[model samples]
Target: MLELQDAFARKFHYLRLSVTDVCNFRCQYCLPDGYRPDGRKSFLTLDEIRHITRAFAAMGTNKVRITGGEPSMRRDFTDIIEAVASTPGIRKVATTTNGYRMAERVADWRSAGLDAINVSLDSLDPRMFHQITGQNRFHEVMAGIDAAFTAGFEQVKVNTVLMRGLNDGELGEFLAWIKSSPIQLRFIELMQTGEMDELFERHHVRGAAIKEKLLEAGWQQRVRAHNDGPAEVFWHADYVGEIGLIMPYAQDFCASCNRLRVSALGKLHLCLFGEYGVDLRDLLQSPGQQAALQRRLREALADKKATHFLHQGHSGMTPHLASIGG
Candidate 1:
């Protein structure tokens, strides 16, 4: 087993893979102008993705998440999912998508052994949804959620990145919807990255503040979900599902973070807030580079920063979330 440590001595094991930098929608938080589809030859081939996934799986990675500019947009998405799911040691095979295209493929995905899904749904209002995603497909996303549930993917997660002026006021409404549904709702603090400043201002809502608000609104915490990632999860006493807070900006989770990121082209990033990454694609192509690649990955983890320096009024040396899987 391979053990890698960050600056704070946290052991890393999870890997988030971005299979494509292309997406179907232009979410304000993800791609403001919609990601142009890179030529098919530019993205990582299924074989390359599987090779790197198998390599990491062999080195003690149990949790693997497929992300993208929007993972659902890829033509060979199911093949990639099956490849990762079939990797020997991967205990969890999850994916994050915009949810627009999931309705048609939910059964297909589940049949391929997908574990769970994290759907990005920012607003409930049609106009606001269109404004946020630059697409008029909110209804499609909602349908996709239903399809996922019908397909037996009961552990569906909804990720809502809370922007101050945009979707903060709708938290109660969104939470109410989540309470009525079977999916968990996760609210993420806006981070200062990509075109963050141009699109929305960082709200910096601390996890404590959010908890207080929920309490004041009569929602009681049930218990934290026993999971590996850093989100603080809570449940409403009267609700069917739970709520999660990903306080990356206000309260960093670097101390307990076990996640690493693999870019669409197969570069391994040790930290989401850091710019550095090791090219694993080269290793897959070379006959004798696997051992060296493992050493380089471990060394990168050893050098991981204790906390992202974004709160110091400076965005850390990290690539855009689309470029690096988030």
Candidate 2:
């Protein structure tokens, strides 16, 4: 069996595959001000996604995340999940969505053998949430949260981007709710990816403050044996759920970074903060090229950057978070 390892000795077992670049919401952080959908209209089909997953699985990729601008927004998303979940060497198939379409199809996705889910939720207040995401689908996202638990997903993570004076005011509310909820939460420090120079300066919240508040509130810090990704996980002594801090800028965790990202258009991105990418769609389209594609992918991993540059407008990352499935 083959395995994907980078120059820094990071064996890549996780694969984040973007299923679509189309999303319903127009979040200020993720998309550009007048972003249009005309770019990269081609999305992978269920069979195409399976082919890519199988190629990665053959190289010891056990966990595959079906991500997107909003994965559930895809018409054949459930089938895509079934395809990757059924792949031979893939042990886990998860998804990250905005939760608007998940309430209606959470059970169906779970039945298809999705191992986990992570919803991008920046606010709990309906009006505030609407303001942040540019849509009035807060109720749907809330319903989706309930549906995920009712449907029995063992790992459901809620991802919140901590921005000062924005959704950061809801940190206390999130911590309070997690005490009784059977789900995990993660606070990602505001990343200055793409063209968000002003946004980064105005609303950038330090992740350390959030962690300090949690510790002051009596949350015990314990290292878990297993982890899904880079976010440092912590548990509250009085809460039923755990919390994580993905401090990309303040606390760099790049030394242990072990993952690969494939854009919805089948481009292999080495780092989220870098502009370099290798085109794999051409390889997928050519049948009987699995061995060749595997070799090429392995070679591409050698170019993975050791760390991300977080300076506003200088990260070198060309695409926005939405396009890269953050």
Which candidate ranks first by TM-score, i.e. highest? Answer: 2
Model 1 regions lying over 4 Å from their true place: 36-41, 200-208, 217-227, 286-289
Across 146-191, the per-residue lDDT of candidate 2 in tens digits comes to 8998899766799988788878878778888888887789999888
Weakest ten-residue segment in model 1 by summed lDDT: 220-229
TM-score each candidate.
0.91, 0.95
Best by lDDT: 2
Which residue runs does candidate 2 get wrong by more than 4 Å?
A: 32-35, 222-227, 311-313
Residues 1-326 of candidate 1 have per-residue lDDT tens digits of 77655668676668889988777777777677667555653768888887777767767788888898788778889998899999998888999888878899988998987999999998889888888888999999999999999999867899987776777788779877977787788888777774565553545445567878877877765553323566777776688888888887655566677788888877787777776677777777653666777777777776777877777656555535676767
lDDT at position 103, candidate 2: 86
- State candidate 2's TM-score: 0.95
The models' CA-based lDDT, in order, is: 0.78, 0.83
